[model samples]
Every structure is written in structure tokens, then in C-alpha cells.
Target: MSARNPGTKLDLQWVSKVRVNTQAVLKRAQQIQGLKTPKKQWQAAWLLKAVTCIDLTTLAGDDTPSNVHRLCLKAVQPIRCDLLKSMDMHNKGVTTAAVCVYPARVPDAVKSLKAANSSLPVASVATGFPAGQTPLETRLQEVRLAVSDGAAEIDIVINRTLAITGQWEALYDEICQFRQACGDAHMKTILAIGELGTFTNVYKASLVAMMAGSDFIKTSTGKETVNATYPVAIVMVRAIRDYYLSTDTSTESLLWLALIKEELGDDWLHPHLFRLEILSSDSLQIYHGTSLSYVSH
Candidate 1:
């Protein structure tokens, strides 16, 4: 929701020179792994913070207006009223950051949010989501249509073929096209890191996504065999920090708030700059004082 990235031109030299030390990345991640979760009051506070940053989502082949409408309702009041009241947060306008759905379901989300009188943005996943193998023209049009349908945000999945094949220029050009097609809608580029195959590839892809005007470079589609693991996220946030220092444009941090606080500092913790894309409702079952592992998905 900040200003657009206004991406730089393709700098093959910067992309080519990057090298990630896999062993080093793994060790750093291990340090985070060994840490303990916060105590009750702090845990409650962090969970509430996480609630405000959630991108309440439903991206299923069976998705319909009915389901999307329900999703919007939940986004408006994500937690039980009593729980929030107990925390004295009932007066706060605590809703998820946005409601994400497939492109065709954008209007459904728009209508539902309007009926609820909530101003939360509707985000759509476009550009042949999950597996972005569609033709370039088709993918670009998907983004345009989503924006026209009242989606304030667009989550796009980059073509793995482009990243894996080392087509940095092509990848940059493609994301640039997505950025252009997005118009005023903020763009969150999904790198689909699990399929990219290496920490080095993930780092390079993150840099290229930022360089190509991605407002946020995300970890996975949540449909991958592996989605949002700690090591991959460590590499991605480090890339975001690197991009910020070099270009003065900051892409949002990775999944873990603690990790964001540690690597990017407190500035990146704000909701406008960072987001947590929660595709499943089960992840929000924390009103019962559940373990933190529930959201580790």
C-alpha cells in the first residue's frame, strides 16, 4: 500500500554476481529454529498483530460466490469478539489486510466487502497461478482483468521455467509486464521458491522480482510440495534487505514476523509494508491458546 517500487532496469551484472552460501543460510535458520515462542501475554499480542496482517484467502478450484462471500465475512471479523474484548482490542478495527481469491472471484469479494461496509482490499491471484505456464499475453491480460474487477491487490506467480532456466532478463521483463498491467493495484510477486531448487536461485529471483517493481516478493503459492520453509525464507528476507539498501525500495518481508524484526528491523513490521497470506481458516484457531505450530504451515 506504500508507493510503487518504480523498478530499475534489468541489471544483469547485479543478478549475476549474487551467490548464496547454503551452509551459512542453513546455520542462521537453525538459530531461529532453536528459539522459544513468546510467553502468554506477548504471544497473545503477537497473534493479534499477526491477525491484523493476514491476507484471509480461499483459492480453490471449487471456489464460488458463496464461499468467497463467507471468506469476506471472516476477513472483516477474523477473531471471536469475546477474545478481542478480553484483550481490550475489541474497539480496534482489527481485520485481515485483504481477502485474496482467484481472478474471476474478485467481483464476489468486492460485493461482499461492500455489503459488510468494510474497506479491506480484495486481492486476486492471477497470471496462471500455482503454475504460471500460460502464454505471456494471457498472463498479462489476467492481471489487467483482475484490476478492472475492483481488486486493489494482485498476487502473481512467476514462471518457474524462467527462474530455473536462468532467464533473468526474461523474468524481469515478464514481472515488469505484470507490474504495468497492475496499474494502481499493488503487486505481490510469488517466487514459488520450492521449485526454484537452490538458495542461490531463490536469492537471485528475489532480487530480480524487486528490481522489476514487485511491491512484495512472496515465498510460495502455498500449493507447492514445500511452502515457506525457514531456510528459504531466511534467504528471501536477506535478499529483500539487500535490495532495500541498494535501491532504496523495500519489498515486504517473509512469513515470520520475528525474522522480519531481526533482519529488516522494526520498520518492516508495520502492516502496510508486510503481509501474512493465510489461505486456510484453520490457521486462525488460536483463540484457544494453541501452540504456535498451527500457523507454521
Candidate 2:
């Protein structure tokens, strides 16, 4: 389920509104969570990704080198880490800058990061996490601990108690405080796609995250069985695309010195769609402006 494979490509299948309901969201959320103890490998991927980008690390404490654990320990030495380490970041790489984990494991993740490049981002979830049902002070402390432990990025789950209830202003305020707490580190707002449950709601969540002060907006926390599927990601990408198209700045700003090599080619449009977190080759292909060859994953 963790689409961290280099060959992963983006092929989002957008599902319009008129398709999701409160019951559907609640039922699906439960299903994804229950999948943590999957009985099959195929079902494992989606269920696994639903819980972690480093799916293989699920058995971090298991003495035996479980398949998923083996996949994760490779990250101990990124060059030798998971499938993402061997990727060609110079060309066809499809990984987020770093792996995300629980706050308690942030140190291990930090220690596992490329020591030479300490800048590699290590994201951690915070602020009451999935349910977002905790007090503000306690949530902030969780974020503080995560950062102090070396998390380079923070992905705080919004206060769904507020967001889902149409309390946009309250949601905005919480995100604002969370953003401020993040300080220098980048913040990725997790919408917990399971709760959103629909394209329209997903779109609204994306906008809310960005507008409220998210450096990047994410899908589910992976704590849920519903991972960052193509359809889920596309909703955010389109929102990002539409955002930049309506802004004063251009895509050139996201690039290095305006055209690191040649002109914009066919990508002259100013869009935030460029900032995506597609973890699989299948998803990556959807937006492949350039093709790449593979090596051993």
C-alpha cells in the first residue's frame, strides 16, 4: 500500500461528488483501520500504505526480519534503505524528501537519514493526530517533542471535530497555531482523506489546508487503510493547479533561477500541481513529463 516504489506513477481516477456520505466515511474509516492486520499481501499494500509510507517498517520491533521490516531497515542507510533510496533523485525519483513516522520514532528516522545531508526531511504527525480530538496545549506539546527529536517536517491532522462540522473558521485557527508551532520546518496538513470521503469534500479540504497555512497538503495519515490513492491525490493536485493559475506568482518561482536548463517547454502554466506526493510508479506515470529507466529496488 505504500507506493514508495520508484516505478510508481500517478493515474488518479477522480470520483465526483454525489457519491459519498457520512455513513460511507465512517464505515470506510473503520475498514481501513481494521486492515492493519491484513491476511493477504495484495490487500496488504493498500492497507499498509494506509498506515505508513514506510510500510515494511510496521514490524520495527519484531526480532525476525519480516518482509516489511527488511524493507524498512534498508532505510537505516538510505543508499541501502527502501526502494526510494536507490532512486535517481537527479531524474526519475518518486519519493518524498524523507520518511514519516510516529514522534517517538523520529530520532531513529533521523539517525537513519543520510548523515551527510542532514537536511533530508523527516516528517512526523502531531496535534492530536487522526482523530484531532485532543486539547490544543497537549497537541502542541506533541508537535514540540516531534521537532525536538529531529523531525524536519510536521504533518498535523486538522481538528476534524471542527472541519467536518463546517466550522471553517475554527479549523483555520487551529491550523494557524499548528503552523506557528512548526516554526522553520515545513508543515504538511493531513486531511485524513477517509474522513473527507468524496471529491468535493476532498477539494474543499485541500483548499482549507493551503489557505489555513499548510506548506503541503497530504492525503490520509496512512494510519487509516485508505492510502494516497490516485483519485485522492488528483483532487489536491487540481486544487493546487487552480490555485497557481489564479495567483500572481508563476511556476518559475518553484524552479531554480527560472529554467534550470531550457525554457518552460509545455509546462508554462503557474500551478501548485507540481508539488505532489505520489508514492508509487503507477501514480507517477500520470504526470510523467519525462520517462525513466529502472534499477534494482
Candidate 3:
């Protein structure tokens, strides 16, 4: 994977001017979802593409090492061998983009993947994940610990209080520190849009994260009452486009846009640039035409 340069110097004036028109965002999202659906082989191809970009996740309080091990196995071979054979994808090096887990479980995930001889990167949620209410020093330490424990990627949640209170500069500085702590590990900054309470705030927070050099700007930690939504995703992706245009760098942006393939093309769907967190097996089944046998950890 190519390295994404960390964003330098927060553009406060530009951030302050960011706005989201609810009606326009909603309309565009609806239109994108209504694009012509790919059928038969095309549908299967797109679903397989979707599977490759998924961050097969298991974020639960009751998670155990055994379950995490099984999750890693599933990540190595997401679809059953029979299904892959039937689709002629059995030996195509198909695998989920990464395995996400809590900071404490990073070692377990790494051990499991190593035992399986799979090199899938383990992504650990850190820095008071899902809430991020802890002190800055503690959060930075959490990031460093996860990286030390064999995590190749650190998913750090931003302080929503900073965004809600319009403390853009403080949020940018804090995230930059967290990025530094990550060292060589990729940093995925989770904005937790559900808690941000407005699309505009989500846009601003997305900009702040990218400016601070987040390798990926994730929509949620999957802990909030509302996780990922279309309107919120639209706002975030637009912010990503804006940042890309302004800097002309190869930064990545992720969204679940299976139907809007024409507009996004194959390049935008790469795991390095975009990721779709599969929240449910049912959604996977709907796309793949077979029941996902593996249970969520």
C-alpha cells in the first residue's frame, strides 16, 4: 500500500465555510442508490468487489480470543470454498481488506493470522475507542500500544465534543498527535457522524481528520445508535473530494456505493482508498446469493 501523506496546516477559513445542504445531499444519495442495478455476472462481480473492500469487524464487549481467531479465519476465506469454486474465484487471492478489533485483542488477532499463514493487516480500535473522552496523552499512548502489539492500522475515534463545540483547531492538533503516535501504522480517524448531530458538522470533522493526515476517515465506530448513513456518507465523500482537489495528493476516501459504480469506476473502489464496513451477514447474503456461514465474533 502506498503511504498517504499526513495533512499539514488546518485550513480553518475553509473549514468554517463548509456547509451541507440537506435537501441536495439527500437527493443525490437517493439518485446514486437508484442507479441501474448490475445483474447476473455483473452483480456477482460487484458483490465480490464489495467483499474485498469490507473491514470484517467484531467489536463487542464479550469478544474472546477464540472468537477473534475464528473471525481471522473467516477474513482469510470470507466466502466458503464451495461458493468461491462455483464463482470461479477459488484461487484468486480473495480476502477481506482487514480485520478490526479492540486494542486489547490485537495480539490475539495477530497470533491467529500468523498461525493461519495469512498476512491480512490487523486494525485495532484505540484511544478510548467509540467515545474518545480520555485525556490526550492517554489516547496517544493507546495508539502507540496498539501499534506495538502488532496492529498495522489504528482506528482512533475523534473527540466529538471538539467538533460539536466548533473547536476545529483543538481537534486538528489532537488528531495530528494521535497520527504521530501511530508512527508507521495507518491511522483511520472515526468521526462517529451519528453523534455529531448534523451533516455540516460531519463535513467539517471529515476535513479536520484529513487535514491532520488520517489515512482513512471512517464514518463511525459502529457503537452509536446510528452508524453509517447515506446522507452523512455523501457529505464526508464530498469533503474528501474537496481535500483531494486542493492538495492533489493520493489520499483515499471510502463509501458503500455498489450501485453507483459508473460514477466511481473501479479505481475508487480499491481497499487502499475506500472501505465498506459490513455490519450484517444478511446484507452480505443479499449481495452474494449465498448465506454467510461464519458468525460475527
- Per-residue alpha-carbon lDDT of candidate 3 for residues 90-114, written as tens digits (9 for 90 to 100): 9998999889898999999999999
Return the TM-score for each candidate structure. Answer: 0.92, 0.57, 0.90
Query: Model 2 segments beyond 4 Å from truth?
Result: 1-73, 76-96, 114-119, 251-297
| Residue pairs with backbone atoms closer than 3 Å in model 1 (clashes) | none
Worst 10-residue lDDT window, candidate 2: 286-295
Q: What's model 1's lDDT at 263?
A: 66
For each candidate in the order shown, give its overall lDDT on alpha carbons.
Answer: 0.81, 0.49, 0.78
Candidate 2 structure lDDT: 0.49
For candidate 2, lDDT tens digit of each residue in 1-297?
Answer: 111111111112321222334454455434433333324654433222222222122212332323323323443333323433333222332233355566777776666554434344566778877677889999988888888887767768887666566566567667777877877666767788777656667776666566565666667655566655544544555555544343334221112112211222334221111223323222211111111011111
Q: How far is candidate 1 from the true structure (C-alpha RMSD, Å)?
A: 6.2
Q: How accurate locally is residue 287 in candidate 3, as Cα lDDT from 0 to 100?
A: 11
